[model samples]
Target: MSGPAMFSRYEFMIAWRYLRARRSEGGVSVMTWISLIGIALGVMALIATLAVRAGFRAEFVDTVLGANAHSTVYMVPQRIENDLTDEVYVVAGRIQDYDGMAQKVADLPGVTRAAAVVRGQVMASAHDKSNVAEVYGIGKADLEAMPRIVDPATLRGDVAQFGPGIAIGAGIARELSVSVGDKIRLIAPEGARTAFGTTPRVNSYEIGFIFNSGRYDVDRTRIYMPLDEAQSYFNREGVADEIEVFVDDPEQVADWTLPLLRTVGEGAQVWTWRDASSSFLAALDMEDDVMFVILSVLVLIASMNITSGLVMLVKNKGRDIGILRTMGLTEGAVLRVFFLCGAFTGVLGTIIGVILGVMLALNVESIMAGLNALTDGGAWQPEVRGIYRLPAELRAWDIFRAVGLSLTLSFIVTIFPARRAARMNPVEALRYE
Candidate 1:
């Protein structure tokens, strides 16, 4: 701002002239192009990978929270004694006053909703096909509250007459080759206790609705029944196996654990979503860190191309550098000129890469759909990936990291060649000429 500033007009003009010079005139034009393109590709790849990884993780967590309870309150097992025969046995404890308990839990602060649930494992059969299913007994109000299941956009059948029938997942329906109005038989191993022993409870119910939760495993094994019907089928009369509790912030379930425990009483225990899926989330985080390191190495390798190109340019322009030095150009000015040559290439390439990466991330889903159409549905498999399509989310932090890494590496690699040109001996450089 005061005197002649750094990177003055003359220095820029000299750098620009060198970058535009022909190969026959002592310029590494091809190497410059190669270095610029390499940097651009590397930066683009880094940004795209990070965006996809973030999107995938976010989507996976959302599906988990959407299709399942954030936390569940369960009655702990207790020991009981039979006075008639003087026999002592351990009986599975169940929430006796589930309606009142559910209401209490729901009324607690931070609790969004709480519903009594009767869950059991049963074998389902239809059209000579059988598969294991996990049945959930939920009230009509609770079912309606679950937007992921009863949402009009994804539900295939009517839930208006839900109590008398059952709601099955799309995967289960497909596996058993059954549709709406078809009767599906459910066989429970622990049914009514009789004189000899317990017998499997077998019952058939009409399929009332089909819902797609967009998760493969959930769709494959889940079955929903009305609360009263589930209670009768599971031999759980006037009681519930557990209370499924939802909260406004699932990630902060730990903060609400004490309150939930106090409300559920001493006989009950609270299990959180993190307890169920922590390992999977940890693995995803590890994968993201590894990917970042791998791509950073790619960017470094691309920046090395800048070093090689600049070194060649320094060697080719030794005589010109000598003349400039003899004509009163300072050593610092010579260094700045060569540095700008490499910096310009790196800066321009990084800008182009940023634009391309952001565009790709924002429209990744549409692009994936196009590719799937061209490849005959081979681009992505919902069953294998657990989601319907590829996802991408661009964040400001990821973009900054990519750009910073590219520019930093460019400047560092350019320094050595610039210093070499600055310290060249004018007499030796021009003696042969």
Candidate 2:
């Protein structure tokens, strides 16, 4: 005859009976409740933490790629040696045909758009307050094409009359105590170099638009001026300092470096967004991994409670186990019965924790808003965290990993107590009776 099947109905019945046993009768005790709650809490914490980490990383990368170029092509001075005199000289100080290069790069297969820009540092003053700003001279069309600047949520002013005025960041406007249609003076120190010395050129321009890119540094320190005006202020004239190139997929920008270098020709280098922000991204990734490992320890400790509960369960059920063993139940069957008890607790706890974690992650924005309101809007600091708000993204992989970790620890810790209960001799178990 075939032996009883593994984890059969009777085994489940026994496990369930044991789990529901009264505290005085060697049934499920306070330890069981504690273990269940601990696992649930540990799982919830892991999922929530991972979701927030993922969201933070995504938001940071989006802000960076949305507000700036995927790659930039700029001229770098090339060292050349004179053949006759053997004297070293520098050549190709600036892009000779930036517009042509931009047009050519824009035609490349993966490139979305290429715009030549003149960038410089200047002091902006209005209402007697002044701040240092990095100004980008770009065409109205190109400025509008930028994802972050054109976004309705962050844009505060109009870009229609861009050429007649300039677009300043919200932080800059606030610091200078100016607003749209107000005049802000831009002072360029290197304006008009002469025989005597360089003179600072101060010019007042109307603020046509304002944008908040959500990055504290960018919003506080960046300004956008019309290409022609920027060229004049920075003394670049017809040449551009760099050509900002946008692409369909920013992640693949490194793949296009060769093509961009070919298009821009010699003395020009391609600098990708990754090159500028790799360290920050790497740090975020490392932190995510470290946090997961650290939180897993909490889950392991919680699972240990299962061991304590199961060991007590085995001790309290010795008499019942003796009767069952004398009645022809196998040791393997007894082991499965107790194992199922612990496994059920882990599985149910994980399910509850997943539900709670997902709900928290989905509602994180609302919760942040509520907290900000209660705290008088002082809960978040964009300058310190780099983003104005907290973000939480629920990823399937993270959830699965948490579940696996919980279940694995639960199963491993259940083994020892299960084996002890299974190997007990019926004679010894009933000696007291």
Per-candidate count of clashing residue pairs (backbone under 3 Å): 0, 0
Q: Per-prediction RMSD in angstroms?
A: 2.4, 2.3
Worst 10 residues of 2 by lDDT: 21-30
Across 208-266, the per-residue lDDT of candidate 2 in tens digits comes to 88998878888999999999899889888888989999999998889999998887787
Query: Candidate 1, TM-score vs. the true structure?
Result: 0.93
Superposed by TM-score, candidate 1 places the C-alpha of residue 36 at a distance from the truth, in angstroms, of: 1.2
CA RMSD (A), model 1: 2.4
Each candidate structure's TM-score, on Cα atoms with residue i matched to residue i, is: 0.93, 0.95
Which portions of model 2 miss their true places by more than 4 Å? 25-27, 78-92, 373-378
Residues 1-433, model 1: lDDT tens digits:
4545789999999999999968594448888888888899889998999999999988888777778899999988998889998988888879999999999999998898999999999999998999999999999888888777877898788988688788999999999999888999999998978999999999999999998887888889999999998999889999999999999998898887889988888887889989888898899899999999999898888888888888988999999999999998888999999999999989988998898888888888998999999998889888888877678989999999999999998899999999999999999999999
Candidate 1 lDDT for residue 13: 97
Clashes of 1: 0
Error of 2 at 377 (Å): 5.1
